[model samples]
Target: MSEHIIVRVAGVVEETAHVRTLRLEKLDGAPFTRFRSGAHIDVVGPTGVLRQYSLASSPLESSSITIAVKLEPEGRGGSAAMHEVKVGDHLKIGKPRNLLSIADDADQHLLVAGGIGVTPLLAMAYELYTWGADFELHYFTRSREEMAFAELLSERVEFRDRVHLHVGVPRDQQPEILEGIAGRLTSASHVYTCGPVGFMDQVRAVLAPTVGDDHVHIEHFEAAEIDTSGDSTFTVELDTGESYEVPADKSILAVLEENGIEVFKSCEEGVCGSCVSGLLEGTAEHRDNCLTESDRADQIALCVSRAASDRLVIELY
Candidate 1:
């Protein structure tokens, strides 16, 4: 497991009925590490369940870090514990990591966010505004009440004119709106999107044809549901030459930890890259949402990915 930083909840803002933004300061009073926009940290909740949340604060602010959380009653209890957190309570958090980041070389940047997915894009807008970049943010929600950081996005940001809010838009009307947005983009326009899987899939399907696959970037909060019925047993070899058999029912992470091999892991769903390790040999059936094609050439996410070959050799810290 990775060593966690202890942070005190300095303040909390109720953004919506089910969402809250938490301001975290180091318990030891040291300055927090500066991270790029769209970075996320692994937070261990009071229930000891770990969850990854995107940083909503400006990257320029190093004094403290902030994250917005939307309470998910159907979730595995992490958000519930976060809702129970209060100011002055200390919590354990991992260092910031980013899978979603701004594209600097684009002629124009288009950020599309849905529901709670606006958290990371809010940070990106802050950074882009500082750079005076050509960018626009489109936020969509079921209703105004469900939109997080409404005031900060519309009123506080310097690029408020570039922000567009689509509240209470019916599902049937969304495709036309998305198509209209896609029609205005040039070949040099780059898109970054984070939202529900279906929303993201639609965004990609609509925008990728205009901007091309290389220019369209996606960030997934959760991995898509994968069918593991066809999963087969495989062998994994550590750097130390120790071997383990990973059954079809169990993940590579479970096999390693069961044998008392500690690994740095957060989201077992493969949305977080904490369990990503170097691939020394063999082919990997990559199922992770975190790694790109180039990344898949040399790396493997141990949590959800499986071996395409009969055996795989991985390097661990």
Candidate 2:
């Protein structure tokens, strides 16, 4: 069951110049349930502006959920409102929902985090630390001051030793440090990356040769906006032999929702993988930022992506 609970901010920890961690406690006698490592919660702000933030705290801790927010100077009032939230002020929040998660069969894990993308990766790292799994975090940022959880992460000697911070310029220019972690890249490793578009692109380019295609996992906070300039209408065939017409201006997801098809979605810009559907036939003109090329052949993100062919068949799971 889903409950829109009013949660009060217990405390705030300023992790960096632009980042602050908010600790929340449910006030309506709702039980604080444990979530997966990469889970996120949607916060309803003062003006009812909804925004999602990844949980930074470990899932093992069920007392409260911690989310780190980075104030964006040009953001659309979401970050600014989050910054203004006081200690005693109540905020509406949804239950935790996980889009990215650790695969149980993954032998070795390579985590790449950039800027505030470290939020989700940090929780995953804590889970790996608890399980004593083979994992390494390659954290990249412009400088140490811009990154959050540096002190908290560094305090843990065991996880700190596994984390290699790459500051200043990009990793491509720093060959020595990249070489040190190069040996860890293998087919047995599951490489998970999260960050901005440019940062994720660079990491994908650098490790494409070593990690292969299918083993690399990724999560994005924002997706690149695409130009939907094409023909007006396309046909979508469901597994039940139902067909629907989707307009070029509208996404497949919107068309489905209009028809009362309940598919999960977060980050409508196509960064989150919540709205992914299985492609049965026809080529998909993938405009999403989440899945790789190989993943696109079999899977399609209903949001921000369209059909390349005149007719497409998909199985909605």
Model 1 Cα RMSD, 1 decimal: 1.8
lDDT of 2 by residue, 168-238 (tens): 86656744555456576676667777888777667666665676666666777776867766646899989
Using lDDT as the measure, which candidate wins? 1
Give a tens-digit lDDT track for model 1, residues 209-271: 999877877888977788999999999999889999999999999999999998889898899
lDDT score for residue 49 of model 1: 92
Q: Root-mean-square deviation of each candidate, in angstroms?
A: 1.8, 2.7
Candidate 1 residue pairs in clash (backbone atoms < 3 Å) = none
The models' CA-based lDDT, in order, is 0.89, 0.81
Worst lDDT window (10 residues) for model 2? 171-180
